[model samples]
Each structure stands twice: as structure tokens, then as C-alpha cells.
Target: MKRERGHFSGSVAVIGGHDHVHALRRLCEEYPDIKWQAVVLPPDSTPCLFLHEDQSMPEGSFRIQNDINENTPTKVDIIGGPFSGIIYAVEELISQGGSDKARMALPSETLEDTPGLTYRTFWTWDHSTNWELSQIGQQEIGVFNPYGKPPGGFLRDYKRCVDFCSKNRIAAIVIYGFLRDSHGGVEAAKELCSYAKERGVRILPGIAIGSYGGVYWEGDNQYNLATWLRKNPQAAATLEKGVGFQICDLAFPLNFPRSDYTLSACPSAPETMAWMEEGVSWLCETFEIGGINIEAGDYGVCGCSRCVARRANEKEAARRRDVHGDYWSHTDMADNFPRLFNAARKARPDTWIYSEIQWDNLLDPVSLEAQRRLPVGGIYQHTTNRTYWKRISAELTKSYVEELPMQPNVLRCQFACQWNGDERTERYALNAPVFAEMAQLSYRTGMKGLTIWGEPSPWYATVELSYLAFARFSWDPSLQYEEFMSRDVAPLFGGMEAAEKFVIAANEIDANQRLPLERLEALQRVCLEHRTSGEVGRRWLSLEEIISRRIYMGE
Candidate 1:
């Protein structure tokens, strides 16, 4: 059989539910030049795109099949088990031809694609004052006072984030900060959730169960859980008299005084457990979120007598691990996680409850058993250290088989930017290669999905390239970082040669932790030479200026 090239002729029709239809409309809007039409099936047969639900397609799976005849226009069929899959198919079509209004072409062959991991997610730390300061580069960003109103442009930025996640095939979005008590908090969250639902994305509110913060109530800060705990010292986790309490101290040695003193609640305390259950229930009742992410606060569980007894009962050491010194050994703090999970599930049976487990606790028998005890559908784990990918992957695979019979999804949190107190030079952390390898490893190890931490900034080429590579690799793990840069990254800069120079310059700057004056000038010259006056070109120029001031001048 001879194959013929198919051309899209502006006019297109869609068939599906309200959300699917809305997504098609958005796609049309994205390509304004494409003349889109709505029509019924059978009688109108004019090169129509069919959308239907198929339970067998599996979660996060979508199929695209094109039929072309000699005398008839090409008929495209998009079949998906979930609505998101259908949206993903449409996104793929837009990327191929719809974005360029000049001509939209489709191959005569059928194309079917499914996510390697079942639950690809993205975590947005939009609420943390520190995160906001780091991300927006503003000195006046307030601390995480959830009771206070959101700063200007918060909603706009949040919508942009949702749109970006939708375009990149992210299945879920986990948001942290100020959703419970900020201005229009509940209403705004519900609206955002509804918006994400239309795009086939799930929105989850981050709930810190271990520590007390704005997650609990809508009243004044003094009346909140954290303050309440401070007043009632008996509920606070007891640390050694002279030993300062900091979550980072549990994992690594630090000379800094404890900043979160009396902020964390004791896991063994019955009152604390009841308060956690009540808080989770309240959140479920207040927001229309798809799920809730339970975070293990800044510091690990308390070292009080009650917590010690619970740890001893579990046959686990209550002390911190030797190597990292950050996480406790066989600590019963994790035991309290199941109570929160159960409470969440009881409140909202259909909601997905995610437990953020520390990396060191993954292999611990106590932690694994605690995970099995919950109605957990997902496990959120992260590591800044890529060296543990192989071990992490293997351990997760084993746990999935021998331990968690529920086969809960494993969501790996990958960091794009690491901020180390000093905000000047820690803006961009280029880890494209590391992200690509982890994506591939996740597939090989039977993990469900991975979420990239931090947002992409347009002014930084390194950040943009890193995000682009990570998104591409997540969509298709078979594509290596080198291939991704050559195909996707290089073209943005005009050609392969320009891309090569840019990549080399980026790698050198990243490895040496500084940009030489000569290297900066050389890259600027290259960028100007091949500049097409496009978005990528503008960003490259912007980045050069930023590097010159930030790195060279020590701004």
C-alpha cells in the first residue's frame, strides 16, 4: 500500500463531553488562524475528529488513529480511557502542525501514545514566602502568613502555571501555601480546581499534618494551631534540653538555632491525632480538590517520652540515622501518617491521599508497614542527590511487589532550582541530564510518575532548557538528553552549531560555578549572530546580561 501525506485545511470538528469540547476550543484559540467548526457525526462526515471514552485505555492513556481515503478527507479518531488522554492527543496534534498556522500536516499512519508512568505530577510552592521571594526576586515578599491576603498577581501566575502543566502533559498539580485562609481562598481554589478539571488535570492542596500552620483554620494567626500548640507546651514534641530543634538538624548537622521551636505537634499525643483528623476533614469539606498532600513538617517527629515509647513498640530506634543524621531511625512519627490518611479517606472516599515519605525511611520496615496501613493511592518521594536513583528505583520496585499490595503510585519530586539561603547566585540549578536519567530509571523501575519542583523563568536560558528537556523526557523517556537538546533545544537557537555553543557554555558555567568574562562575551556574540528575534533569542540575550551582572560583577 502506498502512503500519502495528509494536510490539515483549517476547518476541524470535535465530538466529546463538555470538558473535551472546551479543550478543543482552547486548542483552536491557540491557533487562531485555524478555522474550527462544530458538527454532528454520520450525516456530516467532512474530515471529522471523533472523541469517545474507552475504559480499557488505562489511566493516562490516549490513542490517535488517522484514516485517509483517495476521494475522502482524513478522518482522525481520538480514543482515551480518561479525558486527560484525549487532551494529550490533541496537544500532540497541536505541537506537530496546529501551532504553525501556515500548514498543519498529519501522517497517513496511525499513532498511539501512552504515558510510561501513570501519575506525572508538578508541585508548586506558590504559598511559601521564601519560595515566592526566590521565584519572583522580590525583597518585600512577606513570610507565609496564610491569614494575610495574597500579594498582587498571585492568581494570574497560578493560572499560567496550570496552563503550562496542561500543555506539558502533567497529570496532577500539587499546590502548597495560603489556600485555606488567604483572600478568597476557598472560592479561588475551587475555581482553579474547576479550571484544571477541564484540562484533565487534578489539583491537590498541600496539608502539613506533622506541623501546625495555616492549614488548620480561617481565624486569626494567634488562634491558629501553631499558636495553640505553643500555649499548651505539653503537646509540643520534646527535644533534648540543650539540643536545638530544627528539621534540617535531624538530617544534617547545623549550628543555626531552631527556627521552628514548638511549631510541631507530638505524633503520639491523642489530642494531636484528633486535631490532624479534624483538620483534614475540614479541608475536604472546604475545597473541591481532587486530593490532599500530607507533608511531614520542617522537623521530623518530636523526641519526647511518648514518641520514644511508640518508636520502641515498633521495634525501631528513635534516634536519627548515622550517615544523614537528618531522619530518625525507626521513628514512630510515620505511624501518625496513617491516621491522617485514614481521616482524609473517611472524609472524602474518592480523594487521593498522598504520603510524602523521607528517602531514608523508604526501606525501613516500620515506614513500609505504615504506608501499607493507609488507603494511600500515591507515595511522594524526593532526593536532591541523583546518586541514589538506582537504589531508590530498586527499593521502590521491591516495595511495590512485596509490601504495598495496593500498588500505590510513586511520585518522584525533581528539583529544578536549589536555593541555599544566599539568594544571589542560587537562582538556576541546571540538571537536565539528571532529570532525563531519572525519568528513564522511573520507567525501568515500575514507578508511576515524577513531578518537577520549581517554576521555569523566561529570563534564564538554563532554566528554560532544563524545563524543556525534563518535560520532553517525561513525555517520552526513550528520548535522551542529547537527543532532546539536538531536536528541541537546539532549534530554538537557530541551528545545531548555535545550540552546541550554548550548551557548552551552559555546562561550563554550571560545572565551574562561575562564568568567565571572555566566555560571556563569546556566548553573547554567538547569540547575536544567530538571533532570529524570536522568544528563544530574546531569552538568550536576557540570560547573557543576567550572567554578566550576577556572576561576573557579583551583583
Candidate 2:
């Protein structure tokens, strides 16, 4: 067969195991014009891209080798230990196909890539109510409802998000605010879970144990916790102003003023422990999920008399101090977390369990000890731009992995963009470079995954860019930021010239918090002139408008 001069024209065949058949099919679908065939490998020589397992490749590692010569027909080999590697290899091929190089026949090249982190996960808060921000003193805090249903429905938007992640080869998708609070309810979550499973994506449902939302709060009776609290109201946690048993941290003075009086269940309470086990068991049984994210309590745990005593015990306190150093603290909830984790593990032995450790408590001895005791496989830690604790957190994660029998994975989380009250404000912060650095640093440490948190909002250009950069850097941290911007980001903004101007303006505004009126106007004009008619173009236009308006106002 005569091969085309500058396109994938001649007959091309893909051969792989059952696990990689879908990936091969996808590749064929991506280039419909190209004559593509899927076949099984024979004992004799067959010119094809062969996907095979290689013990030498580490977990989530893959290598692509293009062996094209004059005598031999075009043949590419993708070798990896996991199915995800196959997906990644196919994705790389598709990317190369889009370039001019791939048009001139498969370029003879050998490239090996591996994920720095074991699990690159992304989490959704679910509902709009969860994102409501309230002013508490100087800080504006929002209610974090991890299990709330996503606003404006779930299916269509969620499917789009899953598709993006699947294409990018993200490891997992975690949905919080499931069951009661979810917009479409359990059926929607189940459907989403099934969809993710089909796409080689793991789904983990968030289950809050210590903190119960108002949905479970029945007037004066707070579900199961109310029944226990009625018998011993003193067992409830004592809040800032000594309010008895708050519903959860979300109901604190800022976000949920109505529920401000409600207190979190005391971790030391036997009833609370029993309730946690029952809740975890019920959640596990209800969903066919890969795992459950066990939330110990939002904010801090109970400081009730009984809880205080448990936290104050000298022997336990000393042990905590030894493990956590100056960062150690005694919280009964820390001790109580193990019980909840154990209960969940007992209920679902095969399921993977992990916890979201708040940044403030990352080094807390009680939480660290509980993390060690729990049958959990990983810890999810998050940070904003302020990451002074990053090095310490990484060290602590390394120490825990070394000391423990089962090395737990550490998944670092960061926001793609901050959600200001107005959705437009989200575009103000474009920290791709900063986030990429953090991902690289975390990878160098013992961290196994990076989770970029954001809503599936359509107008979020900066968010999408941040996510793209994060995914790329997580897979290969050695990739430079400027290279990514020039090669990957520039394409989104029409071309390299426009992308460079947009990036420069964005960086200037990000650094100085504002741009000169003339500079702002010039960039806005440039963006307006070069803007395309898609989402990326719209985002650039929107950002330009924001900058122009701000500069004109002279605020």
C-alpha cells in the first residue's frame, strides 16, 4: 500500500488486550478519515500499535515507542502496568495526530512517561447552597457541603466533566453531598458512578460522620444524634459561645445563622460513635462505590468535659507530641475518627477509604495517630496560595508512610480558581504557574496524587486552564510552565501571539492586583480583535471586559 505523504493515510491497525479495546476504538473514532482497523496480535509479525503489560513500568507508568522504517510498516508500542497507562498512551497519540508532525507518517520516537502521583482526583461540592459565602468577622467563610447535589441539575453537566477527566486520564471522581442533599438523589449518583466506572474512573462518595447537615436535623430533634443528646445533652460539643451541640460547622455564626445554636456531636460520646458506624454501614450498602470519603467533623471537634478529659490524658498527649512535634494537639475527634474508619472498613472490607484532613490539622498528633489506626488507604490535604506548610506536610506524609505497615497515599488538593460571589470574579485569579510548582514539589515528596477542585461551570476559562495545567504537570512534573503555555495554552486563545499577550496581561493583573488603564485597554482590544467564537474566546472576552471596567472605574 502507498502511504500518504502528510497524513495517517495507509491502513493502520491497533492490537491490545480486552482492557484496552475501548481505548483502541477511541483512537480509531478520533481519526475517522484515516483507514483504521482493530485486530488481535498474531504469532507472526503484524504492523500495529501493540498495547502490552510491562513489569518494569511502575504503577501508572507508560511508554510509547514508534518503530517505523522503510522495510517495516508503521508500528507503535504502548507498554504499562495499568489500564490507565493505555488510555494515556492513546491520548498522546491523538494529541500528536493533531500536530503537523503526525501528518507525515508516525514520527520515529521513543517516549516514556509516568504519573508522579498514584491518584489524580477531582472533587465537586454538589450544590449552590454549599457555595454560599458569609462574612464571619474579617474572614468570609462558606458552608462546605461535600455531599450536596450539584445546582442546575447533575446528569448533563456531570457527564461533560467525567468526559473531560476520562480523556485526560484522571484517576478518580469524588462527589460530595450525596443521598439526601443531592439534587437528583441517589439514582443520579448511581448513574454517575456507573458512567465513571465505564470510563476507567473510580467514584468515591463523601460520607460525613461527626457533622450532620440540617437535612438530617428534624426541628429540635437532630436525627439519631438528637435521640442520644436528649439522654445526655452535656455530651454534645461546646462551641465558641458555649452553645450546646451544633448541627455541624456549616451552621456556625457565618453561613447558617439559623442553625448556629446547633452543636456538633461529641466524639467521646458512645452514642456518637455508634451513630457513625451505622451511618457508614448504611452508605456503603446503598451505593456501589469504589470508596467513601470519611469526614470526621468540619472545623474542630468537641471540647466538652468528657472530650477534654480524653484529649488531656498525659500518656496519649505525650504520644501525640512525639509523633507531631510542635504541631501536635489533643482533640477527642482525632481519637474518635479511628472508630468511624474502622466501622466503615468493617462494613465494606473491599472498599477503599480515605479522609480529608483540613490543612490546619494536617500535623495534629491525634489526627495523625487516628490516620495510622484507620484502615484508610489515603489522606486528602488541601491548600490555597499560602503553602508555607507544604514542606512540613510532605515530610509528615513521608514519615507516616515509612512508619506504617501499609503506606497510605497522600492526595494534595487546590482550587483551580477562587469563586467570588460573582462568577466573573473567578477569572481574577489565574495561578496555573503557582499550582504547577506545588504539584511538582508534592510529587518530589511522597505525595501520590493531586486533586484540582472546581465546579463544572461553563464560563470558567481560567478554571479549565488551571485544570489542564494541573493534569499535565501531575503526569509529568518536569514539563516547564512557559512551554505548557506556549504549546498547550496558546492554542486555546487562537494562536501563540494572542496567548502570549493574554498571559502577560493576566500575570500583570495577578501580580499588581490591577493593570494600568492604557495597558488594560490595549490588551482588551487585542483580545477582542483575535477572539474566536467558542468558550475559550468568550472567557477571554469576559476577562477583558472585567479588566477594562476595573481600570476605567479607577478603584
Candidate 3:
């Protein structure tokens, strides 16, 4: 039964914890006409959202109840647990009724929903490519860029990203290069973490155990790894002669030129381990960070006598080769990261700790054995190796995943970044189907979440659709792709009619297939048709620019 528009009379009452109520209060500011009032006690007459306040409500679930009675004011009793779920419930209401002071129709229904994964997340580089900073000079395109600029616009961009994540119900964002002098360093990170916390988002700073600049990325701060390495040069990794991590890749030499950010300490060095322990401890102590994402440098392993001797047997048994065709020992990662994970766990017992596993093969004996020894609750992040995902996609199954460790895991893929050396068209291409595949795999395997590059703003149609796909499937992996595109995605563009037209042109551009002159004309026609002036209008324009650029490149 549908309650007619204007049936909502009384203000909506919100009952929950202080943090959730505060968040809801802030959310309601946007919908001024839909009155939302925070209440200490549940009201009998008005609509209420009982956020984690109802005893019968189970964990990771939300319930919405609406009864048909046209005569009485429309009342919706939404009961949900966790801050994100509460936000999601409100969003559902808005989508069902309307938003931005539009007439809302509350209908009769009972809907229950919950997220498929507990830890849906995104990965970003703070000092490099996540934002469009003013004049940073050659350092704005890659991770761990050394140059510094005022946090000004960069921080604002980060806040906007957090807002996007919060709206989409993404639980966390792992930010590398999170600490910098221009960004106010530790104080700034603490503040930003607090901001994310308010919106039910975790800002996990990327901590490199042996590289990527300690707790802080690049700064004169005492906690920086470079600062410690300067004093104890012997602690630095002794790389093989003429070998260093290279950032150059397909078209990246010119398009995304960047120096190697690897400046790692020897994992076996006692001084280095001690320094890392202290740095991680300091980071946990000083900030209110929700978690830590730690990694050993992805480049060459330390060639020091002690380091080489420790991995001799493990490296021999593991015949896996990296992109360079050199012996890349998972044993090296296995040996070093567990200690760091232990350090982080000891420092902050409650925070989530993610240990990076940089290869696609999860069945490798050396790495598999090491995974069992990791802290029980720690999350192992398995990153895809370039195009190896194609094979993984073909062969993946729940039975196969069961052969690996049972601890929580997250699938990390480099779809658009320079690391993606596959044939898939990068940059503006919409890889929603690929994201859907990953989400489904994660769900079937009982993995906690998945991570993708979150630097691109959603204004880019490809990136917008990517974010939408990730958010939609990550929450409910069972949702079909076509339904997601029509029901969830189309609303952003205006409606189904406009969205269908946009998809016809966008798909051609994304596949790198040559678009005939008619398609370009169609894109131009849509742009003109939807040029009413707003965010939706800007989306159409942004998409047009991408398609036009491809045409000009003749690719």
C-alpha cells in the first residue's frame, strides 16, 4: 500500500548511540524538509530508526517496517545495527521516497538488509595522485612523491572522498603517504582519522615495515624511516648491484613518470626491526586510526648476508618469478611481515591490521605455511599480479579457496593503475564487470572485503560506474549486473532513458573499439539534451571529454 505524498507530518525520530545520532543529525541537514530529531527515548507516535538499540536486531542486519494507513501520518520504524547500516537505511528511504526537499511517499513494507562483507574498503595514495593539488611539480602522479605542498585543496579532496565512501557504505580507506609535513603530519592525520570516524569510515594509514618511510611518508620528522636509516646506514637493505625498483611501465615513462619510492631497511637487521616496532607503536599511540595496512617493499629483496642466508632454503623451494623474471621469494615476505603484524597487534589490540601478500598465487607452500602462523585475527591482503587474474578468474572456486588459510582476506587488484600490465583498457574504461567478479569471489570464499584504486573522482563516468559497482556488489554480491546498472546506476545520470543512451556510447569508448562518427554524434546529442546545468550535466560533459580524447588519439 502506497501512502500518498505529503503524508509525512511529524518529524522523524532517531534513537541510537551518540556517534550514530550525531552522524544522522549531520545527514538530515541536507534533507531539511524531512525533519530528523535525535531522541533519548523511543516515541510512540513518530517514525524512528532504532540504531543498535533494539535487542532483537541481529548483528550486520537492518530492518525497515512501514504499515499502510492512509489516514494516519506515515511512520517507518527502521531498526539497524552499526553506524554504516543506519546510514544505509536512511539512504534506502531517500531512494524509495525522494531527496532534497522533494515530496516523499512512505509506503507499507517490511524490508531486511545486511552487508555481504564486514570490511569493504578502498586504497589510495595521499601525497601523490588522489587529489589535484596546485603545482606540485612531477610528484603528483605517483605514490610516495617527495615534494610537499600545503594540505589546502588536497585535504578537502580527501574529505570529499570520505563523504563519498560514507554515502556508499564503504567501511574503510587505506591511505598510503598518509602523513606529510605540508599536511600537518601526525596532528593532521589524527584529525582526518577523527573526521572519518564521525562518518563511520576508517582511515587506515599505510605503514611500510621496511620501506615507504616508516609511520610518516616523507618528512623531516624523527619517526620517518629515512631519518633513522640516515643515522644507521648499516640498517638499509644492500641491493644487488645495478638493481633498483623501477616505476616505468607501458606509456608510464612519459605519462606517469616517477622515481622509485623504495628505500627499504634490511628486514633481518636488529636495529631496523627495533626502529620499525617503535615507529608502529608511536603511530598507534599518537593517532585514533581505525587500522593499519602494512607492507614489505614490493621491489628487490635485501641481499645482505643475514637476509640471504635466512631465505636460502625457502627461496630455493619457491621457484616463483616476479615481473623481472628474477627469483621473488614469498618466504621473504612471510618472514618479515608477521613480526610487524605482531608489533601492530601489540600496540593497538582493537584496530584492524592488514598484512600485504603481493602475489596472485595463494597456494604457494611457503606463503601458505607462513599465513597459518600470522596473528589469528589479522587480515591477509592478496594482490593480483597484473594479468594473472584472467587465470584466477577461470579457475577460482570455493573449494580451491578452502585450501588456503581460513583467516580473513581481502582481494586487492590494480585495475586502472600503472601496475595493471594487462590488455584491459585502463584510465577511463569502466571495469564494473571485473569488480563484480572480484566481489562475488570474495563473498563465496568468505573473504572480508576487496580493495581497488580510489584516487579517481567519481565525475569520470568510468570511475563513477566503478565506484557504484564496487559499492553495490561489495554490499550484496548476489545483485545482478544489469539490475545494478539500471536500478542503482541510472539514477545518477537522471533516469533509465538517459542512462540507456549514455551506456550505448560509453561501452564503445571503454572497450577501446573505434567509435564510428555516428557514436560521437550520439554522445554530442546526449550532452546537448542533458545540458540543464548541475552535477548530472557535469557528468555528461566529463564523459564526452573522455570519448573525444580517445577519438583524437585515433585509438
Candidate 4:
């Protein structure tokens, strides 16, 4: 079949394994008019894209070769490891545009690349930023629940998240408050898990071991932690009469004004351990989840006699080892998490078992011992407290990997979170440079994953660019930030010059810097000049609105 001088038409044959073929199939779904077929090898009768799974290729690696210009039907060969690489290749096929136009965009080049990390993840709170945000939505500090009619509305929002992650090559997304009645309960959650899996993304449901209402958050299920604790008050932690968490920290205090979930279960209680194990097992068996992110409630530590005794013992041991004082919940975690981790591992042996370590520095003897005792395959996650991250930024080294309990370690940071003040004032903050540095740091320290808050919709320019930077840099930390903005993200804003202007304005907005009225007007003019009539054009128009709003509101 001979194609036109500038455009290519007709069917595109996709040949690959089940997963690879499925990835291509989904990409083709949007183009209903285009005929696509699954075959064993490249067929000469039509244009073919062959995805060959090469076992020898290292993890997170892929190679693409295009024979489009030379061949009559136009051919492309994508050889790589599984899912991720396949997704990347097919995404590139449609990078310029989708459907028949995507075929025309195919370039004659040989490219090989690999992800810097094995697991690139995004974390979010389901009841908060994960859903859509609106002007009339609940403006409560951290809560932003923008749900529509019923099950369909909630599920659609989640599917959008999964779609965003899959397209960006993000391997996993951790959803806090995964089970909620308003969101269609267990059935909807199960459906989402299955859907994400098909798209090469994992949906990790966030579960608190002794708080946050267990596996079924807000569900009237037997395993709800709050329900279980209420029924068995003896298992509840005994804090002093008027004692509660103090709002000492600069950021966390603002995010959690009501930090008084002091009704935490006693870590040393036998009943608490049994209940956690049972609840976790039920959750794992019930849903087809990618994995569970278990946290031993960060609200407050149990002050019951048994718990106090355990903490005292841990403190003594920590002192003797000359690594004391920074225990801060590490003792509680060591007491409560082992059995829970084991139960999760037993239920889902092949899936990722994430242990959420609240503190970044695990220098305390109790935390170190706990790390040593945990299962090897577990993904030990360390939180990047703003203050802690700043202080320890220079101290990290490849040797830091040795401090971790497992090979695959992930760093979690906040983006667009109220407690995280970086982009709190204006959501349109350009955070690519921040994430690029994070990716390089994580990759250098032998960490396998880098996670940031992903509750914001990617449709927003800043959020989309932030997600793009996270995906690109985490996949290949070697990518230069400026080049990435120019080569990858610039196209959406018309070109590199326009993109730079957008980036500058966005970053200033994020920093809460005041822009002069004239500057705002100039930005609007730029947006009008280079705007296209497509999605790319829409992004520029969106920026124009933001600038227009700033000028009108005089903020």
C-alpha cells in the first residue's frame, strides 16, 4: 500500500505479547476509525509495529528503531522488557497527536533508554486532593472532595489518575482512604485495582495498622479499625488526660489542626496485633490490589502500660547503642508493624508490601533494629520532612542505601498539599526543577523510587509539568532539566520560548511573588499570540485565564 507524500493512512498492525498488545490496543481505542490488528510478527501487507520482549535487556530499559521513511508500509521495532517500555514506545507513537496523525509523526531514529529507578510512584489522599478540585468544593485545609453523582463519578476520577500515571510511566499510586461509602465502597475499589493493572499501573490502597478505620475506611465493615477499637476500648491507647499532639512543626501543624486522633490502638496489646493481622488478610484476599501501604498511625503513640514499657525498653537499647533521642514513633512502629507486615506478605507474596516510615533519618537504634528485622522484599518508604530534607540534603550518599532495610526504597514528599507550603498559594507552580533534583538524589543513593503528592489533576499546566518531570527524571535521572523543559514540555506551550515564559510566571506564582499588572497583561498577550486550536492551545489559554484572573483580582 502506497501512502500520500506527507500523510500515512490505513491500518496499523501491532505485534507483541499479551501485555504489549493490550497497551497498544488501549492507545488505539480512542481512534475508532483506525483499524488495528494483533499478530505474531511484522506483516509486509501493512504498516507494523513489533514489540519484542527481550529478557536480556536490563530492567526499565527499551530500544526503538523506526524504518518508516524507507519501508513502503512503514515499520517500527520496539524491543524491551515488559509493560513500562511498551507503554513508552506506544506513547511516543502518538506524542505529536493521536489516530492517523500519530502515524505521520513517526520519525526515523534509533533510541535506547532506561529508567533510573525501578518503581516510580505517586501518593495521594483519596478524600482530599485525589479527587477534582472546584471553587465551591470543600475548602477545608487539606480536604478537597469533588465527587459527582455516584459510583461512576468517583470511579471516573480514579481512572483519570490511573490514565495519567500509565501515560507517564509511573508504576504505582498509593490511595489513602481507599474505601469510602460515598465512593461506591469495596466493589468500586476492586474495579479500580483491576483497571489500573491492565494499564501497567499498580493501585496501592493506603491502610493504617491501628487507626484511620482499618481496611475499609468509613465503611461499616467488620474490619474498620475505629469500630474495632470502640468495641474493645481496652485495646485503645491511654494518653494523659489533657495530653495531645503539640503543633510545634511549621508545616504539619497547619495541615493537621485536628491532629487529635489520640484514640490509637496500643502497639503492645495482643488484641491489637491479632485484629490488624486479620483485617489486613481480609483486605488482601478480598480485592485484587497491587499492594498495601501500611502505616502505624502517625497521630500519636499509645500510652498504655504495655506500650510505655515497650517504649522504655527500646529507648534504653537505643541509648546503649549511642543512637537515641530521635526515636519519635520509631519505637511504636517497631512494636506494631512486624506482625502486620508479615500478614500482608503472607497474603500477597508477589506484591509490594510498603512500610511507611514516618521519619527520614533512621539513626535511632530502635529504628535500625526494626529495619533489620523486617522482610527483605518490603518497600521501606521514608518521608521527606521539609526541615529534615533541607538539613540532610548534603549528607546523603550511596552508603545511605545500607541504612535501608530493603533494596527498593522510595522517598515520599508533598506537592500541592496545604501543609506543604511550596505551591499552596498558587497551584500553577513549576516544580520540575525540584523533582529533577529529587530524582538525581534518589538515583544516586541507590534508591529505586521517588514519590510526590499526585492528587492534583494533570490538566493543570503546573501539575502536568510536575508529573512529567517526575516521570522523565525518575525514569532517567541523567536528563538535563532545561533540556527536558525545552524538548519535552515546550511543545505543549507552542515552543521553548513560550514555555520558558510560562515556567517563569508559574514559578513566580508558586513562590507567592507579586507580579506587576503590566507583566500579567504581557503574559496574556503572549498566550494569545502562540495559541493553537488543540489541547496544546488549550493549555496556553488556561494560563491566560490564570494571568487574567490575577490582573482582575489584583493579587
Model 1 misplaced stretches (Cα beyond 4 Å): 7-11, 39-45, 70-74, 98-103, 127-152, 178-180, 212-224, 227-236, 239-262, 313-323, 327-334, 346-350, 360-376, 380-416, 419-427, 551-555
Candidate 4 lDDT over residue span 1-555, tens digit each = 444232234687777745565566655665545566777776767887777777676544778776655547777788876545676666665664344633445544567777788878888776544344432232323422333244455576678888888777888888877887777888898898888876768788887767666777765677776677768888876642332332223334433333323346666778888988898888888887777888776554555677666666555434323542232366666666677778777887756778777654533234565556666677878777566666446777778676566446777764344445532343356677778888888888887788787766766777788889989999889989878977888877777887887777666656654678887787778778867788887777767777788889875
Error of 4 at 471 (Å): 0.9
Candidate 1 local lDDT, 1-555, one digit each (tens) = 857767667676665634377557765766767666655553354666777768678655777788877777667787876647777777777767645664567756777888776666766555432222233433222223333324443455556666766777777777765354443556666777777777777787776654635364333443356666766667776643333233231223334344432266666778777777777777777666677777665345467877666666433443343334453332343566677777767777767667665443444444454445544454645433333444565656633533443355464543234422223333365667767776777676666666666444534667666666667777788886667878887777877887787777666655654556677676667656655676766756755665566445742
RMSD of each: 4.5, 7.0, 3.9, 4.8
Give the RMSD in angstroms, all C-alphas superposed, for model 2. Answer: 7.0
Error of 1 at 371 (Å): 4.7
The global C-alpha lDDT for each of the candidates, from Candidate 1 onward, is: 0.60, 0.57, 0.69, 0.68
Rank ordering of all candidates by lDDT, starting from the highest: 3, 4, 1, 2
Query: After TM-score superposition, what is the CA distance of residue 342 in candidate 2 from its true location, in Å?
Result: 4.6
lDDT of 3 by residue, 170-225 (tens): 87889888888766677777778888877767788897767778777877887777
- Report the candidate with higher TM-score, 1 versus 2: 1
Please give the RMSD of candidate 4 to the true structure. Answer: 4.8
Over all chains combined, what TM-score does candidate 3 have? 0.86
